[model samples]
Target: MKVINTKIADVKIIEPSVFGDERGFFMETWNQKNFELLVSGKPTLFVQDNHSKSKKGILRGLHYQTKSTQGKLVRVIVGEVFDVAIDMREKSATFGQWVGVYLSANNKRQLWVPEGFAHGFYVTSDEAEFVYKCTDFYDPDSEISILWDDPSINIKWPLIGDPILSKKDENAIYLSDAPKLSL
Candidate 1:
């Protein structure tokens, strides 16, 4: 696997080595040893897994946890998505900065979003099946959401029109009112 650095320090993109033959293909999606070797100092301990499906133009986040803060390893199991991560760590040089990655079943690329960041994604294909492993469990009380179009950190979304959002997401606070994290 190859680890690629993003504009944000805590966010990384990992490309796995695929071995394809006449039948299909195979790749080691996650290996504890390889992860430790490739991503230096990374504590690859995931205790929870989550999956979601979205139609094209649907956006699910700009979401993060405050108490049970989750560090996610995200990847698309089927279809494609435009995944993004925003650095919310107040002391970081790239605070409020963001990075995006195009992840798909075809590419087999994974994005590692450590704690102290907000994560989101838009379905770029007709439909996308997204799955991720989190270092922490889902704690609704600790979860926070940032408005997807907050002016302070205007994210260039690949939306055709108004992307579908949950009621909670539609009511998310803007960055100006959102809480900051200390890494």
Candidate 2:
């Protein structure tokens, strides 16, 4: 696997090694030991796996859990998406800053979003399939959403008309007013 660092400190873009032949190709998606070595600082441990599919122009989140240690390792399995991870750690140097990555089946890139970051994605293809690993189980009560287009952290999304969003995301609060995570 090849680990690519983004502008953000802990955020990363990982590309798996693919071996192709006349028939097809094969690549290992995950190996606990290999993943651990690539991630900086403390070792990561995932407890839950999630998969979702969305149509073009669909935006999912700028969401995270405030009361739980929930880090995510996310990737796109089919189609393409403009994935984003925003730094919400109140005490960090990059607080409120966001980074965007282009993930697609052809590229096979994964984003490792550590605890204290809010994550979301925009489907740039006709349809998209996404999968992710979480360090903790879902906590509805603790889940918090920051408006995707919050002015305070204006994300330069490569938009294609208005994105379809869930009610929760549509009603999400601005980052300035949302509860801060003391990471």
Candidate 3:
């Protein structure tokens, strides 16, 4: 796998090696050693895996958990999406800044969002399937969603009008009022 770094410090776009034959194709989705070689500091242990499906124009987040419990590797499987990561690390130079990338089945690109960022995505195709691995299990109480359209951060969502959102996301805190990270 080849890792591509983004302008933001901890985000990356990973391209996996795919071998295709007459019948089909194959690729290793996740290999511990290869991942370690590309990413300098990440826990080898990932406790939970999650997947979700969304239709075009659906926006899922600007979300993150509290520190020590923050980090996820996400990718698109069946369709295309504009994946995003926003730095929330209080001490980082890019704090409150965001980055976006297009991920799809054809590209087979993966996104690595480190512990101090809020991550989200917007489905750009008729339908999209997304999957991700988290170093820590889901903790609803600990999960926090910063408003996807928070003017303070001003995410340039590639949408015409209002994008579909979950009730929880619609009620997410705006960046100005978001819980600050102590670490």
Candidate 3 per-residue lDDT, tens place, 1-183, comes to: 888889996788899999999998898899887786787465467788999999998999978888456578888889999999998878888889999999999899999887778899999899999999987777788888999888888877789578999998998998877776755
Worst 10 residues of 3 by lDDT: 36-45
Using lDDT as the measure, the top candidate is 2
Top-scoring candidate (TM-score): 2
Please provide, for model 2 over 28-102, each residue's C-alpha lDDT reduced to its tens digit, 9 standing for 90 to 100: 888888888877457778899999999999999989998875889899989999999999898999999999999
lDDT of 1: 0.89
- TM-score sort, best first: 2, 1, 3
| Backbone atom clashes (below 3 Å) for every candidate | 0, 0, 0
RMSD of each: 1.0, 0.9, 1.4
Q: If both were scored by TM-score, which would come out higher, candidate 2 or candidate 3?
A: 2
* Residue 57 in model 1: lDDT: 87
Off by over 4 Å in 1: none
